[model samples]
Target chain A: MGFDWAVIHDNLPFLMRGLWNSVQLAAITVVLSFPLGCIVALGRISRRRWLRYPATMLVHALRSNPLILIVFWFFFLVPILTGRPVGDFASVLAAFVVFFSAYFAEIVRSGIQSVRRGQLEAALSTGLTYAQAMRFIVLPQALRSMTPSLATECVIVFQGTTIAYVVGMREFLHTTFLVTERTMRPVELYLFAALVYFVVCLAGSIFARRLEGKAGIPR
Target chain B: MSDPLVSIRNLGLRYGTFRALEDVSADFSRGTCIVICGPSGSGKSSLLRCINRLEEFQDGDVVFDGASLRACRDLPRLRSEIGMVFQHFELYPHLSVLDNVTLAPRIAKGKPRQEAEETARRLLDRVGIGDQAGKFPGELSGGQQQRAAIARALALEPKLMLFDEPTSALDPEMIAEVLRVMRDLARNGMTMLVVTHEMAFAREVADEIVFMDKGRIVERAETARFFSAPTAPRAREFLDRILHRL
Candidate 1:
């Protein structure tokens, strides 16, 4: 099949708009999931059973199910159960938040646990409360170690944004699909979409490595 | 005398049926230093940690400044009055030596920034690392890191200080620098509980010496008497072993 530069040129603006939407979705999901994941991670590692058990169950449950199924649950099942229609964008965002937070929580838990036990003991012995110790001492160090992993997760989340197309969210892939339908140029359009994903993810991985180097934490 | 700054009454601890400490009790009078020395796994470190509630004990209680640790509602407040330095130094790798020293005072004690910084500087100077304040823990030598850890512990102006083999992680030449700083602290009348294998430090600085074995304190006496004429056979054997090693 011959590539059509003119067709892509004609649809460039529309495709760019879809890319913006995808970026926004990924950004919001990532930003919101970070604090939520930290809380969940703290709960997962808490000494209290009330916090630990629920957090453990939630992480496992969300992680076990496929991301597409979670998107479907929010898009279709929520409205049916609540008897109120949820916006397509909101439902998709909610699903992303819920689904990605489970993974993020595990990252955060590992990050926090990676901090030496001596760090916690030092903070505590200095008369800092547990929360204060976490905020000032543990979290800063933990989060630094977590940067590379978290960057990788962001790339994964950005790729996962393509899945939102199934729920009719007009993200990059969805926009590309619409263009291909009208123009009948499936191969070229899909190739272009793949190129965009490759570039963005490659940039993300390089940024992650630079960040790990800057942190200078001994392996 | 003055109700002792800290009193440990029959402290007991266990780890899944392996007793780490049993009936370990002692009183730390104000401005006095006590040295606890024993072979590995003798519960000396565990006994020191229990004073600050770093390790939880199942039986008995520690009374600090007349407040029972078990009944004290504000543990952080109680802890703020005490300082602890670790064998590994435990300096926050992410923070500068200055920030590490100032963190507890600023965040935990709610000291004003100016005041905390001043106190931190004074402490860093006192520990003989005034020039190293801007350096991260990774940038400092082992002895320098230990001194910074001491400064960090002292920033809160604690009534008591606990040292858990603070010089054990240092090189032979580096150990003397840390010991000198600790010796000054002892001379200045800081109430200290030290767990170490440093027999010379125990002899010169400790007001009293405690010897432990198999999770129990086997001997307690004035530092001179304990070194010159230990009452317990275990303590005598330990002293002989350590002295010969040195």
Candidate 2:
């Protein structure tokens, strides 16, 4: 079984479409979840029980469950409840949005916590309101600390886009599967898919590390 | 005599089950400098924080500028009028020294950028860190950072200043630089309530020296009298211990 370059070369266009779908899923999820995560993180640490309890439970609940299960739930349940058939892309995106937001919430919560307590006190004593303090002082510092962790989470979300395959979305993995079935070259196609994921995620990790080095707190 | 700028009456504070302050009373008259000295956990910092309502008290009241802090509707406004410097110079590390000094004025007072920068520059110069204005806090030495923190506090043009062991975190060599800036502020007649262990600064710059032990004011007297003849045995012991270390 010689390695077949012909199949990949012929199907490059078809496979690129799947790759584009994966990229879109990851990019949209990252954009949407980052802010959603920040809000949830704030709720988790809020002084009021009313805000804190539900946020804490939502994060914990989502984190404990598998990502694929959420994808299944959104795929099966959203249409039944809404009485309208949502597209496969929307179903998978919703699942990723809900699932990754919990992880991001934890990351952001820890980042916010990492800022010195004295920073908040200093800001407050300067006559800045609580909102002003968080916005100008705390969040800037917190976001800096969050970068490395956030970058790692982004890579995870990108990789997790593979699970979109189960929901019948023609993302990278599903496209690879279809190609392998058609060409009877499962091993070659799957290996190429893994290579693509590795390259993207590894680049993301390196970029995150460089950013972390630049923004890390001095001792 | 002018009315006291800050009047603390029977102030008591508790953290969980532990009492951090109990029945602590004092008066800080306008344009006067009062130095508070005490062992760790003797409620000096808590008392200072209580003046600005940074810490809630279970008993008594703090009246600042003839208005009760407990009853004051606008805490942010009250805090703007009273500047506090912490032991650790909590300069916003993400900001330039200039921005750190200008933030409160621009945000809290709604001062225009040009106006706030002018005041911030003047304050940075006043603290002797004018040249370091463009630098981030992490790039400056501890003394410079503390000085910048002072400038930041002063940019609000606060009526009263609180120093919570401002020199405690500085290097031994850096301590004098911070004390010098504080001495200058005292000489300029900025109403100050300082919690510190610098006996020399207390004797030189303080109008009154207050000594606390076990959450209560142990001795309060004119600086010369307190240093020369401490009435309380605890005050005498503390002075002896601190002086011996020096």
Q: What is the model-wide C-alpha lDDT for candidate 1?
A: 0.92
Cα lDDT tens digits for candidate 1, B7-93: 999999999999999987878899999999888999999988889999989999999999999888998999999999999999999
Local distance difference test values of all predictions, in order: 0.92, 0.93
- Candidate 1 residue pairs in backbone clash: none
TM-score of each model, in listed order: 0.97, 0.97
Q: On residues B65-150, what C-alpha lDDT tens digit does candidate 2 reach at each position?
A: 99998898899999999999999999999999999999999999999999999989998998898999998899999999999999
Q: Which candidate is the best by lDDT?
A: 2
What lDDT does candidate 1 reach at residue A116? 93
Residues A1-219, model 2: lDDT tens digits: 789877888999999999999999999999998889989999999999999999999999999999999999999998998899989998888889988889999999999999999999999999999999999999999999989889888899999999999878999999999999899998788889999999999999999898889868663
